[model samples]
Target: MWTAIAGGIQYIIDMGASVMLPIFVAILSIIVGVKPGKAIRSGLILGVGFVGLSLIVNLMNDQLGPAAEAMSQRFGLSLSIVDIGWPGMSPITWASELAIIAIPLAIAINVVMLLTKLTRVVNIDIWNIWHMAFTGVMAYAVTGNIWIGVLGTAVHAVIAYKLGDLMAPMMVDYYELDGLTVPHGTSSYLAPVAAVVDFIIDKIPGLNKIDFNADTLQEKVGVLGEPVVIGFILGAAIGFLGGYAPDQALPLGINMSAVMVLMPKVVKCIMDGLMPLSERAKKIMNEKFSGESFYIGMDPAILLGDSQVVTAGLIFIPITLLIAVLVPGNRVLPFADLATIGFFIAGAVAVHKGNLFRTLISGILIMTLTIWIANQTVDWVTAIGVTTGSIQAGSVIAALDQGGCPISYVFTQLFTMQNVTGLVVIGVLYAICMVFYVNLSKKRAAALEAEDDEE
Candidate 1:
């Protein structure tokens, strides 16, 4: 029975988020007092939106990937280790023996935390449970203990939920994502570092006065400053740089423009499904738990719709490659994950309150750290791939996202007894930032309450 259940879940996960999220949302919606018909419609709409979003993403990747590869070749940016990116890393994580058990374990942890009021986030980004599993897989690889791997997975899930809860207000306020929080592996982990960086920027004299953002850009350049226009120009520039003539570049430009225009509409579909459930959850929590508030944790992909995030991500594309060339000892040329630069900077965008300039600076620092960490973790990442049969025994493999994740690197280093001093310093800095975060959350909550009272 247990084996069958695991197999069933694995099957659903294999179907991808577009299918799985809708089913979960529909069932959860019905359970939370939404009418069955409405619940089903909501689910279908959400699913369709995700499908549309996936198509656009694929379109963007198709247009951009070759261009990026061509640019890498044009620039002679060669690194010894092959950066296989998340596509190569995710499969190895799922194939681990710990993965099957991680799903239930993470879910149970979320439920327990919710019941105990240890966390206000009900993390429903079930598809990303692989991230938690990845930590465990790495731990198991090093320690050769199945239980330790399981423990690490649970710990990672708990930390992710807490981080989501702590950052929920900023996400809602800055991104206009009412009642939604991101608990995905990559974005959630960035909150601490982004907060710390933003704090320092706040203290800096000249930097603190800059108020540039999407609205400002739109105001300055009129329609030409629009995200779609920016996307077209950027796409065309990349295509031309990759040696495409006018014929090829125009279509690529149009494709990127379409993605910029359509992505927000797709996100609206998800919000339409989620808002009603969020309202219902809020009412129930208020009545039962004496006005306690909660957030629905979802995938960070929805955050990419913001023009600021996309622009910052696009800016970082060339910057990342430049860093690869300029930074000594850097051995990873970012390829497959080049398109995912948005995820890397999404947290920083929120931290800077959507300030494009500050976010770009923070992104550069974060990406530099990422490249260094990826270089350091190449051997372990390659080993995991080999063990899971994702890569051949002698083949080289490296992950830009997972290996570059500062949180993952810190945790792995700390627990594995490598780089003790560096991890300890990070831990201390994170603790200080957490103190600031808690205070900020409280002030925001209080202000919201006052505004509600006045209304």
Candidate 2:
């Protein structure tokens, strides 16, 4: 019976986030007093939106994957480690024994945190619980102990919730996303880095004066600066650079243009489904908890619709490839996950106040670190792949983002006792960043409060 229950969960997860998120949302909506018919419709609409978003994203992957490959060949860049990306890493994580319990454990932790006022985020992005599971499994794999894995997962959940709380103001103020925060491991982990980078940029005299963002571009360049137009131009540029014929490049440009145009509409549908429940939840929380505020933790993909983020991400593709070739000891080619550049930079955009120039600079630094981390973790990533049978016994494997995640790298290193001193240094730096971030958040909150008073 236990095996069957675990298998059942694995089956639901295997159905993918587009299916699973909606089912969970529908159940939650009904529990929150939404009518059954409306709840079902909302859930189905959310699913449709997710499906639409996935389709456009897949189109991007299909087009960009080959271009990145061709670029890699043209540049004579070769690495021994195969960059299988997140698709490969996620399977290995799901296959772990820890995955069976990761969901319930994370959910329970979230509930306890909320009840105790330890967190204000109600995390609904269940699909990303795999990140916690991945960390747990890595600990188990290294220590040969299940309890350590469980503890690691619990700790990871706590960190994610706290990060979500810290970042909520930025999400609301800069991204204009109210009542939602992203707690996904990859995106949330960058918040501290972005905050630090933004702080440094502010201190630089000339660098701080260059004010460029999506709205600024649109205002200065007219129609040419529109995201769809930008996407078309960028897609064509990449295709041409990859040696595609004009005929071939035109379709790729159109596909990218479609993505820019369609992604926002898809996000709108998701927000439509979510807003009602969000309002209801906010009202209930405020009434029950004496006006306490809460945020719903969500996937970060919704931020990809921002024009500046898409533009910066597209520009970073070739930049990342170049960095991979030039950076010593880097063995990942950044394929499969190249399409994820937009999501990676979304937080940076918010942090930099949508300034494309600042975001690009920060993105370069972030990717440089990510590539180095990916290179450093190749052995352990490969081991996990082998243990889960995701890779052939003698095959090499690596992931551009997941493998390079600083949190994952530090935790795995610390738990494995591979490099205790390095972990200690990283922990110190991370703690300092968190302190800075907390102070910044408090100031921003005060400013918002002052503005509210004036209004």
Best by TM-score: 2
Worst 10 residues of 2 by lDDT: 79-88
Candidate 1 local accuracy as lDDT?
0.79
Error of 2 at 214 (Å): 2.7
lDDT of 1 by residue, 261-313 (tens): 88888878777767666777778777887887788888888788888888887
Evaluate all candidate structures by whole-model CA lDDT and list the values in order: 0.79, 0.81
lDDT of 2 at 25: 87
Q: How does model 2 fare in lDDT?
A: 0.81
**Candidate 2 positional error at 26, Å:** 0.4
Candidate 2, residue 329: the lDDT equals 72
Q: What is the TM-score of each candidate against the true structure?
A: 0.93, 0.96
